[model samples]
Structure formats: structure tokens, C-alpha cells
Target: SAGSLQELLHVDIKVLMAGSTLRKVKSRSWKKQRHFRLLEDGLTIWYKSRWAGKGHSTFSVTELEMVREGHQSEVLLSIAEEFPAALCFTLVFHGRQGNLDLVAESPEEAQAWIQGVRKLIHRAQTMDEKERLDQWVWDWFQKADKNKDGKMNFKEVRKLLKMMNIEMNEEHAFHLFTMADKSGTGSLEIEQFVHFYKILTQRDEVWKVFQDYSGDGEKLMLEELDNFLRIEQQTGERSAQHAQELIERYEPSETGAMTLDGFQMYLCSQDGSIFKPEHQGLYQDMSQPLSHYFISSSHNTYLLEDQLRGHSSLEAYIKALKRGCRCVEVDSWDGNDGEPVVYHGHTLTSKILFRDIMSTLKEYAFKASDFPVILSLENHCGVEQQTVMAQHLRQILGDTLLTTLVDGQVPLQLPSPQVKIYAVGTDSFSLLLVYIPTFILYLCACRLNAHLLIASGHLIPTNSSKEKEKCGAENCPMASFALFSPLLQKSKSKLSRELSDLVVYCKSVHFHGFEHSRLHAKCYEMSSFSESKAKKLAKESGRDFVQYNTRQLSRIYPSGFRTDSSNYNPQDMWSVGCQIVALNFQTAGLEMDLNDGLFRQNNCCGYVLKPEFMTDGNAQFSPEKPDERQGYRPLRLSIQVISGQQLPKVNQKEGSIVDPLVRVEIYGVPQDQAKDETSHINNNGFNPVWNETLNFVITTPELALVRFVVEDYDKASRNDFIGQFTLPFKCIQAGYRHIHLLSRDGTAIPPSSLFVNISISELS
Candidate 1:
């Protein structure tokens, strides 16, 4: 009867198993007793309606299981299969161990030996046939050979082995390579690699053997290799374990990994000498591409806060605030009778109660450290409204907020200094008209000891019509310089100067700005000639040149820069090409960190333009035609590594030897700035300085060679490390064809840093 009731565990057992009626149990005793009758069996039981609402019911069982274990039979728990309904099931047993004993023996074999759990319930699904070992290896080799090179490089091979959780060093690399290159020509060709692939994929047993041999933990060492050869000489061929042991013996002392050079020595008693010119000075040159950051001003504070909502959780937002983001904007407007309320609009509907937002922030606020959150309140109304809002912010954030006007006027006589307020101005508005003059307001805020003040304004263009008309082309520079001359002559006050610095600090400054093609889509125009002969003529005649014009300057210069076209004029072509070369060096060779600079040049050729800072309705410029007002084009330099050499293996137990500094120097500058010149700096062409005093010892032949990257020159230490740097190659109308190192032209140091040694076997 109990087994039948257990079978109906999911449904009401009284109805499903017992076939008894609930109406028959209707008595005063049934209400107080908390009991029910099973339908079919007419069995009485205690019950509670735990899951009252959702379409589910709860049940519990109190049972006993007694088994003679030595006699050997499986006793299954039927109640445990019902999940949460059997959550409170109590199974009383005569000889079974308790819950604590089961936990303790789980770590030992007692539970495994006594549980009688013969079958495994969970198993993994079968993988697709395409994912077999043979297919994976073929795909890996193809992708690894980027230029269809027959062999895979260290970087490419290392990445694949790393994914398998088997760090394949140089020693193990050749072992696997030789295994795959079955016919042993020191290389594996694509067409001839069919059998290895077939063996790898055809059987799981074969694949497993390869995996074991490839794994570093099981690979052969040098001692094992020698033993294998000695034994094989007496018998026949070498075993896989012997080969693995031979490979393991060549592991480097420092990292216990093998490099290509070390692997070759161990495998074939040969050192390979293949070098690409581009990879020569890789460790010495440190030029890197510039990093970009975007800054935008929200028209009002509520919109700014609303936009940032989904980016991070409230907890994360508070965490970020604690980390460092001090300058924050809050919009406020005048309430009834000019009581300040934290709202961005003049209308009352847009107003948000200050207390509500503060309460929400407090709920999730990180309060480990105390750092003031600078609140910039913009008034929709006039200065009067701004004054009222400042008072309200001071009340809400206390001394954390400050109030000041541009003319060095402070409001509210608080005991401690309040927060600094900045007055923002636009190109269309003068400083005095925008709430408070920005510069003067910043000074006033500084006098009150405010932490930050942001003076928002537009950078007036150098080529503005008003500016051009005042001085024309010849005197444009003088006119532009004259306008700012007066500001430089003032008797600088401590507060005013400090405030000016604040403005400069907060301003989004662009360094080495250039136009890029991605953002400035219509900046350059490309036209192709129908006939190749005509196209050649046009290109030769300097008539088919494409031009890039900035109808509007980018928010950041060179946000969208372009390259030269195939049909461009020689002068234009060379200039664009030089720029590409220069930018390449800037990104790849030098090691200076720039806030903003020329990142990289595209494959397409065209000159870059400073996006017009401000656009004019009347200003017209042709995209196909050039004007001298576009300014002087400067030549850029890109560095290339020509050649390099590695030192001979040495025994490190002896004295150390210093490595020679490999240097490349570029020298040449045009004597006259105005000369239409084509001379490299100092008439020697573009030179890069590369000196390598940094050295590591090779103490033992066992594992001494290590690879290190030479990034860029450290101005302070006079050494090099991999870092961001920029070498500004200054040449106008100057063409540098190539980079050279140690040359009457470009020579190598032949054998300067090479060192090798051999010691007696007794030293080992």
C-alpha cells in the first residue's frame, strides 16, 4: 500500500492511489486533528496546505528501510525522486550510517565501496564529426600560416597550444613538429601532410597518443632521449616516450620553455638564420598609436543623469564616484517665489524634489572614503535663478558645493568655503553675458578654495572670415597672435592665474591632430580614369590629384583621416606617402604617450586637413581644388627594422659580458624653411637612435637564452622598454625614402654581442 502511495507522489495520493472520498472524513474531529484520508486505501494522514495559491501541492513521508547489506541487494529511495515534495522525508534505517558519516567518508573510498552505485547517470553529448583531431590540426596550420608560409611562427603556435592548457615551449614544439613531419625534411608541407591528418582523425586511440606526446608534462627529456638511443642501438626504433623525454631535457632554465633557437639546436644540431627586415629593431623601437577619449556636455543635468542610468548599477555608480569622478553637473530651476529646486526646465513639471534623488543615492552609496562630488548647476532662467540654485545645492551637499560669480564675487557667508562655480560661454556669446564671465568666475571660485571649475567655451578658428578679413593671407598669423597678446600682458593675480590653469586643465586639448577618413567621409574625393594610359598621363602631369577639404573641423582633429589615391599627383602622392610613413613610426617606433595624435594612416592616399572648427553658411571651398590657406604640409617619418643578431650560447656560471648597443641615427634638416626642398635631415635621410645596453646572462648551456622586447628609449634612464612614445620627424616638403642602422648605408654589427663557452663535464 505504501509503495502504491509513493507511486502517486506527484498527485493527491488520497485520490490517485486509495480511491477514498474526502466527504466521508467530514467531522468536527477532522477540523481540529489536521488529518486527511487517502482515497483508494482509506488511510488517514496529517496534512498542511503549504503551497496555497500556485497550482502545486506539498507532501512529506516518514518511512523506514532495513537491509542486510552483507547479503547484498539495492534499496532505492522512492521518496527522494519527487524533489521538493520529499524535501522533509525522514527515512529511519537500522544499520545505515548517519548524514555526518556520509559527508566524512565522501572524501575516502568508504562511500564508493559501500554505496553499490554501479551506473553513471550523467554523460557528455557526442561532439560533431568536423571537430575531430585531423580537421582541427589542418585548420590550425592554415590559419597559423598567415602569408601561406610553410612553417608556423612562435607567436602563432604558442596561442594554439595555450588554449589547450598545454604551454608548449620551444623544446616541445619541435618534438611535435617532427612527429607531424613524418618523412622528416625539417618541415611539413601542406600537400604532403595528408597521412598525419588521416592518422590524427581516423581513430580516437591515435589522437590520444598525439595529445599525450604533445603535452609538456609527458614529453621526452634529453637524458631519456640518450637512454632511448642507446637502447634502440641494441634493439630497433625509438619509442614515443623516449622522444618525449629527449624534448623535455632542453627546457629553458628561467621559464622552462623552449624558443625556436633552442629547439633547433636540440633537434637537428642546427641554428636557423631566417630574418625579416621589419622585425629587426622590434625590441628597440617603442612608438605606439595614440589613445582617444570622448567628452560630451549634456544640455542639462537630468538628461545627463538619465543617459548614464543603464551603463552601470546604482552600486557600481557609487563605487565609481568614490574612485574618482569629482566634477558632476546638476541642473536646477527656480520654484514658486524663487525657491531653488533641482530641475533643468523653467516649467514646474520637469522639477524633481532634491530629497528624493539624494535618498536613492544614499541607499546604494559607497561610503568608505570621503570625496566631495562637485555639482555644476545650470540655470534655465537668468543669473538670479543661478544664485538661488547655488544656495539650494549648498544646502543639499553642504560645504561640498560653492557659489561664485565670474567677476570675483562670492555669495553666501558660509563658515567653510563652498564649491566653485564656472561660468560657460559660447562662440556667439561674450564672457560677461553668459551667467557669469567664465574666467573671472573661475577666479572667484578659486578664492573660495573650490576644488574644480570648468570654463566651457569654443576654440575660435584661426582661419575665421573675420580673422581673415582683418589680416588677409599674408598677415593671418600676426592677426591671430595679436588677438591673444593682450590676455598675456595682464598683471596676473594669484586667484585669476590659478583659475586660468583650471580652465586649461579641464579643456579637451588635442595634440598632433590630423584628419582621418572614417569620420570625414566627404573630405576627400576619388576619380578613376577609364584608360590606363590616360590615367598614367594625368598622374604624371600632376592634374589627376585628389584633394581633402574639411567643410567642418572634427571635434577632435584627424578623427577621420585619409591616405593618397592611385592616380594622385607625384607631389601629393609623396606628401601623403610620407605622412603614412611618419604616422607609422609615430605609432610603431617611438615611445611617447600623447593625449591625442596621428594614430595611423589608411592604405588610401590623401592629405589630412584640420576639420573646420566652425562652419560658415557663406564660406565655400572646392573639394577638387587646392588653396594656399590650407597651410603648410609637414613630412612624417615611419621607422623600419632592417636586421638583428643573437648572441652565441654561453655558460653562465662564469663572469657576465655586456651586450653592445645597436644604434640607428637619422640626421638632416633643410637649411631654409621657405626653400621648396626635398632634402632629408642633415642630408643623411631619416635616422632612428637604437642603443641596447640592456643584457641578461647566459650562464649555462642547459637553458640560458631568453627573448626580451626593446620598446622605446627612456629619456630618464637612457634605456629602452616597451611603452608608448612618439618621435616627431620634422621635415616640410622633405622626403625620407628609408631607415638604416649602423651603415655607410645600413650595416649590421656582424658578431659584436655573440659569446659561447664550453666547460669540463666535472663542472656539471
Candidate 2:
């Protein structure tokens, strides 16, 4: 009886039959506020209750009916005359009768009350009534099946739940759909489908709903629909209000209303809640520039000590760091009593106390400006000492530090206004969500990419929330706060659909020089569920579908990109994940080596393509999309060339035009042409070395292996790299010979030697 009542109302309210006839009703109290939710043809109202702990109670109602002014008098007379046993009818006239809100004292009473309301609201005056309901149900199924692949997959379903910040796991996801698939066809069919939500989301499986209703037979029946819809609407309303308040509190606009984009900005702002930037030093300015490229040099005990010594004095440290390094990496372990002291590795020698290091920096009069440190703490200590390290770091650094740690185990890092701690090293990424309730891998990815932190995939937790939040409404209680992923999608309350509006809010924060890491590849991955639909539609439309995944990143990203994989063994898959964002790409103080061939040959050249819409640094992509497929626009590029030698352009006429499938050539010249040799081969293949051209032949995709030949010769070895470039077709082209002799260090390439860029567009 309790279960049935809970399903119809979608509330966590318990009806205790304390003494048979004396049933006691207790509702879950709101941890936050009250809101409204939608169910098909009905709605649910939710408010915090003193009796209920963390769940909501929902009740379904039918649409109101209208009667002429004179008819109301007749309707009341007819009801009293025809069925006197029925509860007294109340007229909430906005001209007619609203749906009945019947109160019942027993389970049987409530059941009778609902039946009465259903009869009163469901007007079967014509055949069109049934047809409309059928059409509505069918339309819903079509809409939910985003890929049009005939089945609603987990990824798709999870995206819907993500808007509400709910995270579901696979086993639970299966259970959710099984309950929703009313016909038991092992799949959802419109015929058996109803707008019943409580039937869909009553399970408590961790990831069941998060997978987007994957793998199962879960179709909601008509009877169970109202409760789910009502709960969702109520939760959504409450969440929207809470999110708006957060935006208003942290980043209020000149106007009272906060834009969605502005709210996103608030989360990713370094100077805001999660990351706070304090000004220091004599030249401190509110408008002081921050470093974009965060360079970290790793070494053993000697280098570690040297780095510490280099930054021992304020003047010296400022000079070394002002040259523009963003992170200072260190290794640490727990002492006998669980005290966190910094050391390179396990050692018997004197180790540096974290306080001592900070005191030394302080003694040097190093201002906060000189030490905008992202201390990467490598925890070699066991799990038992994990919290101890965290406690010590928080104690030593207070509010001025932002640190990231990665041990193999998931750490218990919670969210606080002052300290932003994340568990970096994990195998599934989802484990982070499991271990730490408020920590999300999705946000972590965004944080790392936007220069909020340097994240290793093992310890990094961004993409998991995107994949974890799609539990079907049937498998879990709508009001379970335990089901929500606070890090991925946040909400002031569990039932709110918009949750905290974290995604949109973070987007706004990113624009105001606050780096929200989730906006990049993580967005692409989260957006992929939708983007795939676009790709499918384009295929149907006969347009090329240039869809890019994590695998194809090499085609676009530069070849020399390196990430923090220190915690993992070199061979672990987590150690070699693709970089979603290159945080260091935009730092201004130092000349970056953009041409490291991590992607293609002649590693000395790199290109940065701006999407066509960016103008004056304002992003042009429409932030919102009707479907996931609608929003991504075309890409434009701005090329940056960094070479140990000069770069040569493709000479139109004189250069050999090798067939696309036959040959390839990359040109390199001396940094200073006057000091290098120039060459051109004669018809006899003899010594007319003034302008010699180099050609590389390729008969198959594997022939591109010639790109690796640079490793053979000492001088030319390691000169060319093929990191992320994809050799799509069997091809070859050896055109112009423009080689430049460059000194060991990459600096001062002669401008006249050759360096040029051209624009091209490709769809993804």
C-alpha cells in the first residue's frame, strides 16, 4: 500500500499504519525549497516536509474542465444527487472546475480518490481523446530516441538526466529501462508506453538511469506516469531558482537576471568560488596578466632540491618564475604520525616540511604574485594517510593554495569555497564519482584544460559525469539526493531538473578570463551524444559526416602535446589519453615550441585553427542547440609557426606535384640562411646543390612511416615528429627544398628563410 501510494504521488512520504485505522502520513522534508514538476496530463507539487528526510512527495492531477456559469450550479446539484458517497466537490473557478485534489484517510481512500480524478479529468467525449494520448506517447519515444537508431541507448538517456545532475550506473540503467518497457519486448514500444514516470524511475541502481536507458525493456504504463512528471517539474522549478541565486550571488550582472552563459563563467572563474586569485607584489594590478602556459619540469632529488633552492629568495624566485613557469611539481609522503611533509620520494634524509617551504618563500618576501603555484602533490603514501595529507595541505596553505593529487586510490576530496582538491589517478574515472561524492571528473577535465589545474587522466574526473547522469525515472526515487552527481551536474536539491545550471553557468565564466575546462573536448564528448545525431542527419542528407572522436584528435591537435601522466605506469591506457585542451597554448611570456611534430612530420611547425565564428575573441558558436547536432559551427584557423629552422612554402610551379597517393615531402631550412647551404639538383642528378629538393614516396598509408626517418640521423634525428597527424590516403609529394641550419636551442629563425600559412576548412 505504501509503495503504491509512493508511486502515484512520487513522494518519499511514508504512510505508517501505526494502528490499523490510525494511519500516520509523514512527508520528506525539503533540504532546499519547493517546486512544480510535469507529468503527462497532470502535474506534481513538491515542498520540503518536516517528516521526510531527503525525498519529495508528488501527486498527479488531470487538466481542469470548463463549464458555463449556469452549468456550475447544475453540475454541483448533479454530483450530490447522483453520487452522495463521493467526497464534496469544491469549485476553483477561473470560470470552471480545476482537477480534483482529493484527500483520503486510507490507502483505499486514496485509490478511490485518484480514480475519481482520472474520470473527471479524462474526457472521452470523442475518439480524438485516445488518439491524442497515443500520438503524444509516440512523439515522446521518437524524441527520446535521439540517434534514430531505433533504440534509446544509455549515452542518450544519461544526457537527459545530466540536466538534472543525476548519475546512474549500468546495472541500474538496465533495471530502469526494464521497468519502463512495460510490454517486456526487451525494448520500448510506443503502444505500451504511457506518460508514467514513477513506473520508469523507481530503482536505486547507481548508474542505471545514467546510461540513457540502455539495454532493456522499460516502458512506463499509463497509471504510473503522473507521479514521475509531477516530481520532475517540481524539482526542476526548485533547481532553476537555486541556480539563478548562485549566479546572482557569485556573478550578478548589471541587470538582475543572470544569463546562462554568465552562470557557467562563475564556476570556472579563477578569481571566484573554486579558484581565488589574490594580488601580491609591488606591481600588483587588478588587471595583472596571468600565465597561460604552465610549464612543469620534473626531476629526481637533485632537481627537486635545486628548484626549491632556485626559488629560495624572492628576487631570484621572481626572476626564475617570471620567465613564466606555471606549476611547481613535488612529491610527498606521510611521516610516522601521518604528517604530510614534502619529499621527492621515500627517504631517510631530512625532508622539507610544507610549512618550512612556505616560510622560506615568505622570508624571501615572495608575494602571492610570484607564487601562483599549482602544487602537484604525488602521494606515494598509502590510503590510510590520504586524508592526513589533505588535512596538512589545507592547514599549511590555508585559502591561498590550489592543489591536485593523484594516488591510485580515490581520495575523499570535498568541495569548499577556499580549497579546490581533486583525485587525479583513477582507472575508470567513474571511480572518482564513487569515492568522492562532490568530485566530478567532467569538471576536473574542464579545470585542467582551462589552466585551472594540471590534471592527469588517472586522477582527473571530467568525462565520467557526462556519461553517468542518465538514470531512467523508473529505477530510482526522484528525490534521492544520493543519486545526484554534485561534481558533474549540481543542484540545490535532488529533484530539480535544471539542477544548478552548472554547464551553462560555467560557459559564461569562461568568457571573462575564467577558464572553465569543460567547455572544450569534454563538452565535445558530452555534446557528442547530440553531435552524433547531427552526423547521422547529415549522412541522410547526403552531406559528408566529418565526425571527430577522441581517436581522431591527432588529426587536429598539435603533435608535441604532453600531459601529466606521472602517477600511471608508462604503458597504462590512462597514461596516454588524448589531451582535450592545451592549457599552455595561449601563455604570452615565453616563445612556445608549437612545431613539435607530435601530430605530423617536420615537428617544427604547428597550427592553431580558430573556429570561423570567433571575432575579436568572442566565441561565435551559438551556445545553445535545439538538438546536439545544431550548434557546432565551422572552424577557422590561425597558424603559429615555431621552428629550429626556417619553414618553406609549397612552390606552385617548380615543385614536383606528386600524386596524392604516391609521395610526400616536408621542407625545413636553416634558422639563418646566410650561414647554411642551399641546393637545387640538376637533370643529371649531379652537383647543382644550390636548390635541392627532397622527395618522399609513399604507396600506402603505412608508407607515411617515412616520417619517422628523422630519428635515424643525429642532426636530423628527433627533428621531425608525427604525433597527432593522420595520413588519410596513400600519398606522396616532394616539392620544395628549403632547409635551414638551426642552433640546438630553438631561437632566431631567419624571417627570410621561409614560413607561411594558408587557411582550410574541414567539418567535424
Candidate 3:
């Protein structure tokens, strides 16, 4: 809790020290002036009506995702004419929480609140293990100070312990409390309570590991630290240099030796974080064809709940895109006034205007990712409404809409989404739309190298060969490509030619057999399969599926049977090299967890390069038969579940403490798939110790995803989920690492983590 983090804590929210009144804009019609103030802890914002005597409502700092100034949000933009843009801002939260739109009386006031909240968010996000512990202890101390007198006595401390998921023996707890009461005062202040917290959370597991490595009990010598790094952590030739760096960074005092505190700090530091640091940046080759990467996509993106009755919203698209969903689906149906509405076409679902969806898409397309965002228009509209949709897309998306073919011609290889290409406006975009009844057509000025080849109906290599020759003809007057898919053709009578041309990279097609795809599929052609169908293909013809995806794209969507908006196991699709495994982003579960974890890398730009075996065109790889093929050696992974730190309590039942257990699950090839569980630590969600070692033999290490879940054990009914974290096997760092848990909605639950020792070695 020292240095820059400490400074950041104090500087954050300082601007909000003096309270101010701001207009809380709910919608255009509902606006109320409220007095908003930051709490003394600088981690919560308390707001209330100016005259009401009602208890104040508060928002936690950790819940905040970001603050946007100058009418960036839809809510802020809604009342843009009413309020000056400089005075308007939005507070965006993590997960599915609704955004808070506010307008200050003055521009200075708005800027102050915006910057202060941002700093506070940065402080929370940057806190390290030790800093987090300190902050957590302080927050608990405040919570347990029932009298609000800024101090706590033994009785209050006891209550705090219960709230923290500890059912310790009374005598022992009092003993530790007395030890921290150094001032001889009957009550302990915030600092004293923090000291007591340190005593309670002393890591014996860390100490024993340190004792095994350190020559002396007090400090680990340099050579001994190096040995631990090489042997336990499996570090390579840079172990000595890495050990020196650790000593310099974490050692309490530069005495040329690492103390136990330093050793623990090193283990919890970024250098020792469970996720490999290299993968945290733009490390992957983004230049590869988009099909070569597993793209994060959303299914039924506008629906916030059950597809049949859920509300449709632009907020849903905003949230998904901000969370790095690269591809978003909009089921377009004709609405009143020639507008196209997006929703479940045949259901009683609510609708959002297609133009509004496009507006939101344009605003947030590159917010989290610069890579191209594919608008999978499930067009169910007639020609009039479809043309309107086309106009809105061209007007709203304008320059972002990549309308021309690569090299002014159909390419032998699909263009990468990150490819640098230019096809400026020739003002013929609108002309491309009104020409045909069911076809979308657009051709850039034929000035580049190769001739463009396209077909009006479901175009593929073998089937659309005649259209290819016609499209290659000089001054080919008409421009149209594939709009026909099983899903769209079944419903829609007409779709705009311009809207279909807007669909780049993801040229949807009805998937035939693998043999058919191998013979007729082109790089740009993509197939959408329901989860059931994809799963069957993966099980029956896994190798052929993998091979077909190497040059082409495949999207696996949820089955229509999932009426409740549930998700299928995306791993089934991903195992067969299916790139866009779209899930119901609104639904939070293991499926979403895996999706988040898989794409939670490479700056989370919504693409993870598929494994070499899956992407290499000539390589022979089978998802079902991983053992028989490959140069990669099998891995023996050993994970020691050490202790949990401040786990969350589910069920919200008063006076109920959690009986938490840690479960390590592996998802990948069927042979490598397994789950290992530790016995539950009863009545303790705070700092529970298991020290149980779970081991697994992973045949396909490249494909395996490791998920660590902590659950509240219930003997009477099903166990409740507390928190989880998932990441690829290759991103894992060996030796002692902390798995910081995330809430069910994939938001960070700070200080809630499992301290574990991970060791990965090649299996004999």
C-alpha cells in the first residue's frame, strides 16, 4: 500500500471532497437534481434528494467501469439539446448494470467529477495484492464500526470476523485482537484493525514454501531464490536475472536478500500473475486471416433476457461491444414507417429500431477493439424497410463500412479484418441499394490489381463459378453477392442490396456436409450452425470440421431450443476450429465464463489466434483424436489449492457463513477434459485453507482452458456459485500464483482470490 498506489488513493476523489448538486438524467422526461458526494473512504458515492429525509443510496467505486464526458452515452445523448455537451457525462458500470447519466451546473464541475471518478477507478484497478488486502481490511473495519465512531471494540471486531467468513475460536480471536491493541485502548482504530487483519491472514503455506527455498528463516539468499524460480516456477535461462529483479522490486529493504514478505510479494506480483504477461498485450499476429482466430461474438445481442419476452435495447449492443464482442447479430424485421426493427422475429419480444442499432454500433464499434466488427444482419424485412436499413447503415456507419472487394477483385484468400485497405466514397452507395428487389449490390471503382468475382445468391467456389466469370467482365454493370442463407431465405421476401454488400468477411451460407464445404467453400464464405448440429459434427467428423475451418469461417449459435436464452458449451465448437462461437452475452454462466476467458487475451480485441494445428492448412489435426497427431508433448499439470482470500457469500441469507470449496476444471479435447475438487472448508469464506493438490494429464495442452471456481457448498441442495476465473493453459504461469476471482457476470471481485501453486511439466 505504498508509493504510487498510495498516492493514487489519496489523490482520487479529492476533487469531490466538497459535495455538489448534479442533475440525474434517467430519460428525456425524468430528470431530478440530486446532491452527490464522495464518501470519506473514497470508494463509494453517496447521493440523495436535496429535501428528502430518506436514507442515502450509495454506489461503490469498484462497480464503476469508466466515466464518459460530453454526451457520450445514449442517455446523455438523449437530452443533448437540453443540456450543454460539456456539462454532460455518463458513469458506465461493469456487468449488466445500467449507466448513470449526470449533468453538472457548470462545465468545471462536470470535468472535476469526471476526472476524480476516473482516478478513483484507476486506483481500484491498479491495486496490487498487498494494497488490495490493506484496502479490504480498511473497508471491513468501516463496515464493522457499527457506532460510526471511527473505532471498534472487541465485540465489534468479532462481528466483523463473522462478516468476513471466519468462524474462528473465540479465545484465539480475542488473543489476536489483544495483540493488535498496542495503544492499550479498549477500542481499535482503522490502523489497529488492519494490523489484526494481517495477523489473521498469515500465510503458513507461503512460509513453508519460503522455508524450503530460503537458506535462512528470515531471508531467501539470491542463489536460493534462483533455484526456486528455476525448479518450482520452471523459469528458463533468465532465472538468475529474474531473481535479482524480484529482490530489487519486492525486498522490504535492499539488503541483497528477499524476506518472506518479499517472496510472497513476488509470487503475487504481475511477474508472477497467473496470466502470462506477454499475452496481456497485442502479442498475436493480427495480420492472419480473420478465420484463423476465434472471434468473440454475441448471439441474439439485443435481447436482455428470455428471447420470447425479453426487452430489446441499444444498451445491450453497447455493453457487448464494450466488453469486446466483435460480431453482433441483429434480427431485422419490418417495423412501422418503413423502419426495420431488431428482435426475435416470430416471438412476442420487444423491438429496437434498426437505425438505432446502427447508431450504437457506429459509436462503439472500435471502443474496445480496432478490429472490424461484423454486423450479422438477420434480415427479415421487405424491400422498402430493407432499403431504409441500407440507408441508415450507409449514413451512420459511413467510412467504417468497408464496401469494396480486396484488390478490387475477389481474392483467393480472405482479407484479414486488420488489413489496411481503402475504397473511398464514389457517391454510388445509394445507387447500389435500389437496383434489385432481393439482392444487395456494390462494386468499388475497378482500379486495383485483380478483377472482382461475386454471385447474387449463396456464392461459393464450385457453385458460383459462372457468376465468377460474369463478375470478372470489364464494366460489369450490376454488383451483387450472397444474401441467401437458410435462416434469412426461409423468412424474408426481400433484402436491400446495399445492406447485403455491407456484410463483409462474414458471408453467411447454409452449411452442407464437410465434403461439400471442402469442395465448394471459399475463404470469405461463412456457415452458421445451431449448437446441436455443430456438436454432432464435432463429435462425428471432428477432423474434417477442423480442416474445413482453416480456410473458411464458421459461426456456432445457440440452439432455438434454448428458449430461456441459455448457452451451449462453446468448447464443442472451438475444439473443431469454429471461429465465431457466439453466445447469449446477457446470460452469465460457465459458457460465458469460458468465452470471456478464451478471449481475455491479446488485449481482448475479440480475437484469439487458433492453435497452429487448427490454422495450418496442410497440418493434420483431429479434435476427437488429439493423441494420435502432433509434435506437442503432453503436459502434467499440478495445482495446489492453498487458500482463499475474502470469497463472496451467495444466498444472502443472514447469519449464514459459506462452506466454500475450490474446483479446478479442464475443458479441451475429450481426453484432456477432467475436473478436480478440494474438500469444502466449512463456515469460512475468508482465508480458508485447503492445501490440497490437484493433478491432471493434458494431452492437448494448446487447446485446454483451465477454470478455477469457488462455490458455496450446500449439502441440502445444489452448491451455489461464488466466483470463477478461466484462462488458456499457455497463459498460465507456474509456481505460486493468485487466481483473482470474478463475479458471475465477469466483473472483478477485488481481493477475492485463491492463492495457489501451479506447476506444469511435460508428461513422460
Candidate models: Cα lDDT each = 0.25, 0.26, 0.80
Cα displacement (angstroms), candidate 2, residue 279, comes to 27
Backbone collisions counted per model: 68, 116, 3
- Angstrom error of the Cα, residue 379, model 3: value is 0.7
Give the alpha carbon lDDT tens digit for every residue of 558-618 in model 1: 1111111111111122211111111111111221111111111110011121122111222
Span of 10 residues, lowest total lDDT, candidate 3: 435-444
Tens-digit per-residue lDDT, 681-708, candidate 3: 9999988999999999998988899999
Top candidate, metric TM-score: 3
The best candidate by lDDT is 3
Angstrom error of the Cα, residue 679, model 1: value is 41
Judged by whole-model lDDT over C-alpha atoms, candidate 2 comes out at 0.26
Per-residue lDDT of candidate 2, residues 1-764 (tens digit)? 11222344432112111111211111122112222223232222233344557865543232233211111222233343432323323222111112222223344544443343344344322213223334334444555666675665445555433322233455775677677766666655443334233344222221222122222223222222222222321223344444444445543355444333333233223212110012111222111111111112112211212322221111222222222322333344556765545543422334545444444333322232232333333334444454454454446454443322223222222122112234445675553321221111121111211222212222222223332355332222111112223442331211112211111101111111112322332221121111223323323421111122111110011111122211111001101111122222221111122122121221111111111221112222221221123233332222211111111111223322211010122211111011111221112110011212232221112111111111111243232221111111111121111222121122211211221111223333
TM-score of each: 0.21, 0.24, 0.89
The per-residue C-alpha lDDT of model 3 at residue 500 equals: 53
